[model samples]
Target chain A: MPAGPTERPTIGVALKWVDLRPEVDPLTGAIHDDLHSFGCSEADRAALEWALRLAESWPGGDVDGERAEPPDVVVVTAGPAEADALVRDALAAGATRGVLVDVAPDAPSPEVAALLTGVLEGADLVCCGDYSVDRGSGSVPAFLAAGLGAVQALGLVHLEREPSGTLRVTRRLDHGRREVLAVQAPAVLSFEGASAELRRAGLAAVLSARDIAIDVVPAIAGRVARTQVTRRAPYRPRSRSLRPPAADLDVRGRVLSLTGALVERTPPRTIRADAAEAANLVIDQLRTWGYLE
Target chain B: MTEPRTPDFDVIVVGSGPAGASAALVLARAGKRVCLLERGPFPGSKNMYGGVVYGRILDTLIPRWWEEAPIQRWVTRRGTVIMTEQQSLTIDYRTTAWGEAPYNGATTFRPDFDSWLAGHATDAGAVLVTSTTATGLLRDGAGRVTGVRTDRPDGDLSASLVIACDGVNSFLAKEAGLYPHAVPENFTLGAKEVLALPRDEIDKRFGLTGHEGADFEIVGCTRGIAGGGFVYTNLDSIAVGVVLSVTQLATAKVRPEELIADLKRHPMVAPWVEGADLKEYSAHLIPEAGYDMMPTLAADGMLIAGDAAAMCLAAGIWLEGVNFAIGSGKAAGEAALEALVTGDVTAEGLAGYRSRLDDSFVLADHKRLRRVPELLMSERMQTQYPQLMCNLVEGMFTVTNPTPKKGVVALGWQELRRAKVKIRHLLRDLWTSVRTFG
Candidate 1:
C-alpha cells in the first residue's frame, strides 16, 4: 500500500462487473439452454455499440478498455470468499496499493467499516457513487464517514487531480445551482448523477480484470447513536415517473441543504402527526427485511 | 404476406384495425414472421365506434373472450321502434343465451379491443410499429406492389404483398382510385358520447342483471331526417349517438353533436343516462351509402378490406359494422398469405379474396342487402307515414272523454279527420310499403 499522504485525500470506487441476466432464455420455457435473442432491428444494435464506445473514453479507474490506461485508482468489489484468491492475484500483479470498501449487500455498517479500516488504514481518501443504482438511498458513504471518523462531502459531482497532488471537487444544489469546495487531501467524497459520463469496459479490459482481486475483512460499525425512523413503500413501476416539486415546495431559494426538501403547507400550518411514528414504521419494515439497525 | 425485411418475414400486414391485427395474430401463431403497422398512436385511436360489434365473428378470433377482454356487457335486450309526435310503437326482444359463455352478442370499445388484439400479435412474434402510417404501395415496374413507403425516416419497407384494412374513409382507397365518392347525401355522419356510471348502477337503471346489456334504437327522432339515435350499454358507461344523413344535416344545418345533446335531454333518454359522467364524445362518418359506396377490392398489387370497402349495413333500423370489419380482415389475411406462397400477388391472386368472401357471407351479406339502402328512402317514411302513425297511435289513446263518443271503445274517424292525415296519403303510403317492404 502507498504511504499515508500527509495532505492529499485518496479514495476508492466500488463497482460490480455484473453480466447480462441468465433468465432471458425462459421466454420459450427451455430455461437452462444457451440462448441468444435475434429479434432486435439492425439499427438498434448499432445504437448499443455506439453507447459502449462512449463508456470507454474516461481517463480514470484501475481497469483500461481499448487504448485508455488505468489512473492509479483501484475499484473495490466483494462477493463470495472464493473471490479472495482473485484479489490476491491482482495485488501480486504490479498493483502496489488497494482500498477496500465494505460493499457486502447485507453487511452491518460497523462490521463493514471494521474490515475496511484494517485494509485501508494508510489511505487518506475514499470515493463513492452519490447514489447506488439499486438503492439510490444516497447514504452509505456518509455513514462510512461517521464510522471511520473522517470529514466527508456527501454531494460530489466533479473531481480533478492536480499536479501538486490535490483533489478538486464540486457539488450539486438548489436546482441547477452548484458549489465548489475543497478539503486537504484525506477525506471521503460521494458521487452522484452529476458525475461525468459512466465508462463501459470493453472485452479486452474485462479479460484483464480477471487478474485483479480484492481482500475482504469484517468491518465493525459502532452502535447507532441516533436513528431516523421513516416509512416509505416500494415504488410501483407505472408510477415511476416523478414530476418536479409543485409550487407548494418552496425549494427555489438557496440554503445549504443537507437533506431533501420537506413538503410545504399552508400558512400558520402545524403538523399533528408524529414524524417519529412515521419513521418508526419504515425502520420496522426494513428491520423485518433484515436491513436496519 | 412475405414482407421481406431483407431476408424473411412470414407476413407483412398494413393497417392496425380489426382486419390487419387479426390477420397478423393468426399468421404469427403459426410461427410465421409478422410485421403489423398502425398509423395511430394505438389501434382504434382512429376508429369510430359507430355500432355494436357483432360478437359472433370475434368468437372466431378470440374464443370465449368476453370473460377477459374489455367488453361492456353481453346484450340481452334490443329495441327497434318508430316514434311519432306523442306515441312510440316499439318492438323489443329479450334473449337469455346472450349471457352464456358462447355469447350471442356483446358491446365493445374498439380501441380497447383492437389494442388487445395487437398485443396477441406481439406475443406471436409480430412487430407492431405504432404512429407510422404507410403512404402508398411501392410497386416494381412490372406493376406488383413489392413493398410500402411510410412517413417515417428510413421507412421504405419491402413486402411480398400489401393488404389494405384501412377504415371507412381510407386514404389508400382514394389514392388508388379503388373507391369512388358516394352520391350526394348517400353517406351519413354519427356523433357519439360515452357517459360513465358504476356497473351496478348501470344494471339497475337499464333493468339488467349479471352481464345482460341493452341496445335501444330509435326512429322518428331524427326530426324528419333520414336517421335516428341509438343507446348501447358499455361496462360502466352508456354509449349514445345519433346517425343522420350528411345531406339532411347539411341542409337543416344541424350538427350531430347538437342533435345528440337534444336526444340526451329527452325526458325518456335523460333518465337512462342520469348521474353518468361524460368521458369521450366524438363524431365519425359512416359510409352507409352501401352499393353506391362500395370500393373496388382487387387491383394488381393489393386487397382492400373492412370499412375501406364500404362493408357497413345501416339495416335501416341501426348500424352493425365491427363484425364485418373483423371477418373481412381475416379473409384478406388468408388470401394475402396464400398469394405470397403461390408467388402471385396479382389481381388474379387477390380474386380469391372476393370469392372466399362470397362464401364467408361478408360479401354475400352486402349483396343480399344491396337493394335495402335504396328501398329505405320511400317518401312515406319521411312524411305521410310518420304522421299517420302519430295520428293513429295518439288518437287510439287520446279521448274527448265526452258522452256518445261511440261508447268510448272506438278509434273514431272524426279524430283522424282532425289531424289532416287524409285517407288517400295513408293508402298510397301503405301501398308503397307493400310494393317495397312487403
Candidate 2:
C-alpha cells in the first residue's frame, strides 16, 4: 500500500450519528420527534479523539527511527445525507478528511462493515466506538474486522500506543476483570464510549469545516442480513412453584404459615461465628427459603 | 513595514440573536463573507424574550415573513391595565387587521424564532458556528479591533470588522470602553413563565379564534418594585411575567417569582391564567434605559447593535427590543458594506451606522422617548398613579343613593388628595410628560 513505513498512513474512524436521548412530553407522556437532539454518538466521538491522538503522536512514522510523513485521520460513516453534519463535526475536531458513504438509514451492521471495508482499504488502522448510542448492537467492529482479516480488539476501556509502533489496550471483562492486549498495524480497535472525550472544535476550524466538501460515495450492492421477530412481550420473572400449607388452622396462623412471614424474618442479631459455621448457617437459610433442595 | 494580515472573513457577527442573525443575513445576501457565532447548541437555545416580536422591521428583509416564520400566534388584542391590590382598571383594544397577512406583532418562542432567523442567514451563505462563545475582542497594535478570541482552543478568528450583538451583558462592548452607563440603574430584570394550556382552551379563555392572540401590559403589580407585569397568549400557552428594576429589586428582598405570583393571583389577572401549568421559567437582564444608556455605536473596526448597543425601546405602551435590534443590525450590516466598498473599516468610516440608525425608527423612537423609563419607574408613577386612577374610576362608576355622585373632576381631585399626590408634583410630572412626549 504505497511505500510501507515511509509513506503517510491513513487512520480510519467509524462514525455514527444518533440522537442523544428521547424526550417524553411531561404533560402528555408522548415522545417528541425532535430533530435538534440528533448529533454524533458519544462513543464515536471518543474513538475519533483516540484516532486523532494516534495520528498526532506518530506525526511522522516513528518506525525504524526515520522521519516520515504523519498519518491522516479520516472519519467515515454510512448513512443518509443528514449524517453529513457528523462528518462536518469530525472535521471540525481536526480530522484530515471526511467520507460519507451513502446508504440506507437502517442498513445492518454486516452490510455497513462490507461497504466500509472496501473504502478503508489503505488504512493501517481502523478505530470505532464499541457501540452506537441508539441501537448499540456493537457488531459492526467485529464484522468489519472479519471482513478485513485484521486483528480485532473490541470494548477497550484504556488505550496507549507504544514507541515501538504497537497499540496496547485494556478491554473490560465481566465481573470487573480486565484483559490487556497489544495490537499491531492493520488492526480494528473499538473503544468504550466513556473512555475519552472529543476535544472542542476551534472556531476557525468550525467555520472552515463548512467549506470542506465531504466525499459522498454511493453504496454498492452487498449481502444484507435480515432479522425477524415472531412474537414480542414485556419481560417478567418466571414464577416459582411453592409448596402449600395445610388449611386447617386459625386464619392468622394459616396466612403466616403459607407466607412464611414469621419463620423467615428475625430481628437484628450478630454472633462471632467460625467460617465453617457461617457457611453452614447461610446454606441452612438458603434451604429454608427453598433456594436449594 | 510588514504586510497587513488578511482577514478570514469580511464580517464577524457575534451572538446569533435577532441583531447578529439579521446582520449576518444582510451581509451574506450582499455577497459578503460573513460568520455568525452562537454560544448555544443552536442559535437560540440560550435566548429568551418577553412575549412578542414586532416584526415590521423584517418586512424588507424577508418579504411577508409571517407566513413561514414559526409564529405561535398573531396578537389581535392589546390591553393596558392599571391595578391597586384589589381594584383594577383595564383599557382593552382589539383589531382584526393584525390577524391578517403582513401583520403587526406576533408571539413566538425565542429558540424557534432565533433558529429560524439564523437559518435564513446560513441559507443565504453566512457561516453560523454554534456552541462557541466569543470571549473577547482581538485588537491590533494600533487599538483597532481585528477579530475575536473565542472560548475554544486556538479559536482566534480574524476578520476585517466585528459586529457586537452579544446581548445585554456584552463583555465585548465593556472591553471596548463603549458602555459608559453600564450599571444596575440602567438595566431591568425580566422574569417570565410560559404556562401550557390546551389550544382550544387558550382560544376560549382569551376570546380568540384561529391563530389570534392577546397581550396585556399591567402596572402597579410589582409591589412598588419599580417595574410592571405582562400576560400574553401563545398558540397553546400563555407567557406571564414581570420586569423589575434591578436596583430596586436588589433591596426589595423579594424574589421576582413572588411578584409574578402576586400578579397572577390579582383579581384582574387571576381569571386569564386560571389552571395554567408552567412549561418554562426564565429570567433575563434587559437594557431598559432606552437612548440614555446606549453605548457608543461605533469604535475602531467595531460596531455595536442590538441589546449590546442598548437599542431596546423600553418606553411605556410600546415595549419592544427585537424590532430595534433588527433595525440597528441591518443598519450595521449596510454600514459595514459601505465601509468595505470604500476600504475603510475604521470607526470614522463606520460612522454611517449611527446616522443610518438616526434616520430609521430605531434611534428616532429611542431619542423621542428617552425619558420614559425614568418617568415610568418614578415612585409616584409606580405606586400612587395606578391607585389614584383606579380610585377615580371607582368613584365614577359607583352609584351613591343618598349622596349625589361627585363630578369627574372633583372625584379626581379627591382621589389625588387621598393618594397623597401633591398638586405641584402632579403639575411638574404633567409638564415633564408633555415636554418628553411632545
Best by TM-score: 2
Instruction: Give a tens-digit lDDT track for model 1, residues A24-112.
Output: 22224323311111111222122222222222332343322324233244434443343342233223322324334444444543444
Model 2 stretches astray by more than 4 angstroms: A1-10, A26-29, A62-69, A78-80, A101-125, A130-155, A163-165, A172-179, A183-188, A192-194, A217-293, B1-3, B398-407
Q: Local error of candidate 1 at A52, Å?
A: 12
C-alpha local distance difference test of each model: 0.63, 0.88
**Docking quality tier of candidate 1?**
incorrect
Question: What digit string (tens of lDDT, one per residue) describes model 1 on residues B1-438?
Answer: 444446225456777888788778776776666768788756777887755666678777778666677777888888876665455666888888767877767788777878777777777877776667778767676666666777765566666666777777777766777877745566778889999887899998889988789988877667677777888898788998988888888998877888787778876678889878887898877777675568788777677888788777766664678777778888887787777678787899778888878898687767666666655554456444556566666666666567434433245365446545677766765565465344
B1-438 in candidate 2: lDDT tens per residue?
221478889999999999999999999999999989898888888888887899998998999798789999999999999988998899999999999988989999888899899999999999888889999989888899988989998888888999999999999999999988998899999999888888999998889999999998888999999989999999988999999999999999999999989988998778878998888899999999889899998898899999999999887788998889999999999999999899999999999999999999999999989989989999999999999999999999999989998899999989999999999999998988898877
Interface RMSD of each: 15.2, 1.2
Highest lDDT, which number?
2
